[model samples]
Target: MNLQDSAIVQQFQQHCSLTEEEKVLLLELEQNPLKVNAGDIIWQENSKVDQFCTISQGWAYSFRNLGDGSRQILKVYLPGDIIGMRDFAFSNRLAGVAMIEEGIVSHFSHEHLLKIFRHSTALTAGLFAIACRQQAVLTERLIYLARRTAQQRLAHFLYEMYLRLGRIGAADEGRFRLPLSQEQLGDILGLSAVHVSRTFTAFREDGLVLRDRHRVTLPDPEALAQLAEFDGGYLNDAVPALFFDREWQSHMLAGPTARSDEQMPGKSKAASAD
Candidate 1:
């Protein structure tokens, strides 16, 4: 399968059609496959970012390392996610990005990307819209950390992940691979490691979710959204019509697999904490 076969790339094309030359350019850009192992550093803070990358498989994260030996995860990059799209205009990076598991990524030089944009209006606008959406997601995450309760934050986080995964064909109903540790979750939520552990316990006790090794399954996504006071509408683009149009809905549903109606979280009464 090609990069265009991926759901996100498909979404981009549907929103704004790419020309034949642009498609050829993208294919050339993705000619080489880059691999990074778990725990390997991809890029460091303040480094000059010369390339843009798209995750072809597995997970990675962008984070800022605090002086106190802690890291704040800013965003999780999943398959079909592009990094450096938002930061390419800037000369310096404020955070580091790394792979969370063994993964393959596609890369292109930033200057070449700029050139493509200069030549293709459709590509530029679609990319800009995607980047702006990512910025909004990050900004909302900051608001959650600053103002929401631990339980609420965790619930919102899980719901958001499920929704995103569903978009990219990674989730079936409420269940999906989490691919991050509690410590990492803590970092993302601005909580201490211990607090993350305890909050997770409480969430389970209240019948929210079950966290297994690198997997989280939600039994009741609707209830979870209610608990978190989350509205899935925010996860959509700023375009109001996109939020409710059947075409966009069909796009989200156009995946290789169908979400099971008999959905249950992987959580069981005897489930062990990872």
Candidate 2:
């Protein structure tokens, strides 16, 4: 089977159709897979941030080691996830990324992204939409950590994972593999190992979640969402329809790009108050 036209591109641009040349730009990011084992560090914190990567096989995550000798996991990388995006603008990595399972990573230079941005406005829009959606996820994470109970946090995290996996067909009907351990969960959830274990057990007993080792099955995802007070709306993108010129359908025309207002934010305020 060919690697081009893979699900990774489809996930990134669910709302727009890519021209043939645009598809090539997207596929360029998926080239050159390097096999890595579990616990492998793709890149360390403070390393030079000049690349973008895609997980073509398994799972990975970005995390930070706290000064107090603990870890704080920032995001779980699924198969179709574009890693290194969080640091696209930075000269050095703010956090370290590592593998959660043996997987293949397609690593490409940050310049490849520049090519996409210069070549395809539709792709740029898709990428921005994804970034905004991810920002929403991070915002929800904040709310859960600050206001939710331990059980609520656990349920919300698991259900969120279920929905994410379902998008890539790795999960279905609430059945999915969570390749993470209790200790890892603790890092992601801002809880101690024992607290995560206790909360996991409590939710299990309450029939909010069921697990067989690493495999989790949500017997009633609706009920689980209810218990967590979770909102799945953030996962969906609301990008507006993008249009391309008939003469330049495959890519954006080459020229000086539009400049942002120097006054920017304040200028928008000058335009409208309602």
Candidate 3:
């Protein structure tokens, strides 16, 4: 797909419709896209922070390293997510990001972002809203790590990924490509690799999920959500109406239409806000 017509653009449009001039400004901000190989470090910890990028394809993650030299996976980035938004307030990166698979990212320099902020209230507000949502995801992950049980944590994580990937048309029928290895899953979920393996066995025995190597299928989403106590409300909150087009309200509940054949099954054809 054309870079401008990609899922990230559709996601931005859903947040706030751009005027013709604003759209042109966005086009100008799109630098030549970067191709990232699997396991490549896209952003290094403590690096100078001068630009951000959108995940035009594939998956990546942010992680921090402790004094003990152990790594903690912070958050996962899917297609359409704006990477590095969390560092906008800082002069240097707080965490490093690495690609989980070969992917493309579109860069926007800090100067270009400032230009949009000064000239387009609607676009600025939309970007701010997206940043807020990203923060919410972090907060929820912290909560899950601190309070949820192992089973609950894994369940919640899977359900959350389903919803997030579905928003970008990367998931369908409760099935999606999960490129993380058992070791990586353990890193993110605070489990040992053995524990991750055991948890998968338990989930399979319960018939909650079907796994075929890197592909995952949630056969009974409602049951799994119930187990996780997952509430998708945080992911679906409406952007404030003032910064959006008149049509924004209608699209708010519908979300960005799927740009690929993948879609969430067992829901309405339109992406459900709930």
The global Cα lDDT (0 to 1) of model 1 is 0.75
Q: Which candidate leads the pack in TM-score?
A: 2
Sorting all predicted structures by TM-score, with the top scorer first, yields 2, 3, 1
lDDT per model vs. reference: 0.75, 0.81, 0.81
Q: Write the per-residue lDDT of candidate 2 for residues 23-120, one digit (tens) a residue.
A: 77778887788999999999999999878798888899999999999999999988877888989989999999999999989999988888888877
Error of 3 at 257 (Å): 40
Clashing pairs in 3: none
Off by over 4 Å in 2: 1-5, 243-274
Write the candidate numbers in order of decreasing lDDT. Answer: 2, 3, 1
Clashes of each: 0, 0, 0
Clashing pairs in 2: none
Model 3, position 32: C-alpha lDDT score: 61
* TM-scores for candidates 1 onward, in order: 0.82, 0.87, 0.85
Predicted candidate 1 versus true structure: per-residue lDDT over 1-274, tens digit per residue: 5656754466565455565566665566556678879977778889987787878778899999999998899899987678767667788887888999998887778777778677665566667767777887887887788899999998899899898889788899688988788899999888888998999899889888887887787889989999888866657634433222333323334542657642322322222221
Model 3 Cα lDDT, one tens digit per residue, 168-215: 777898999889998888889987888988898999999998888999
Error of 1 at 143 (Å): 1.2
Report the alpha-carbon TM-score of model 3 versus the true structure. Answer: 0.85
State how far residue 248 of model 3 sits from its true place (Å): 14
